[model samples]
Target: MVLEPIYCPSCTSTNIVKHGKSTQGKQRYKCRNLDCSRSTFILRYSYLGYLPEVKQRISEMAINGSGIRDTARVLKISPTTVIEELKKRS
Candidate 1:
């Protein structure tokens, strides 16, 4: 078996542990690093909306004059996701 190293996305620490499965059944991992702000994360997200980076992009696209549909299409996420994120910012 090829052992792949798992690193915490928040702190880039190798001290990771299997936390549990996400609602969608993705393998979730936890960072053992005491300074980590993130609780749990999956190495690969099945949905674009689940990624923090994508959420940031959603905010940026909105500020940069991209419409909801435009941001959804560009980011390949749901229009509702874009709208929800924008709503949270306000």
Candidate 2:
């Protein structure tokens, strides 16, 4: 078996360890970098909206006059995710 290198998404640090399993049974990892803002993340996200890049895109789409349903359909995420992300920005 080959071991894959896991890096923290927030800090891009390799100093990470297994934290626990997510609700969906995905392996959760914890970042050990002191300067990192985010603590834990999963290697694979089941939802596109759960990704940081996708969240940014959601905001960008909203700023570009995209409706919530449009963004959700384009991004392949739930409309509720778009709404929640927009709410967080406010």
- Residue pairs with backbone overlap in model 1: none
Q: How much is 61 displaced in model 1, in angstroms?
A: 0.9
Writing each residue's lDDT as its tens digit, candidate 2 over 1-90 gives: 999899898889999999999999999999989999999999889877899999999989999999999999999999999999999997
lDDT of every model, 2 decimals: 0.90, 0.93
Q: What shift in Å separates residue 10 of candidate 1 from its native position after superposition?
A: 1.5
Pairs of residues clashing in candidate 2: none
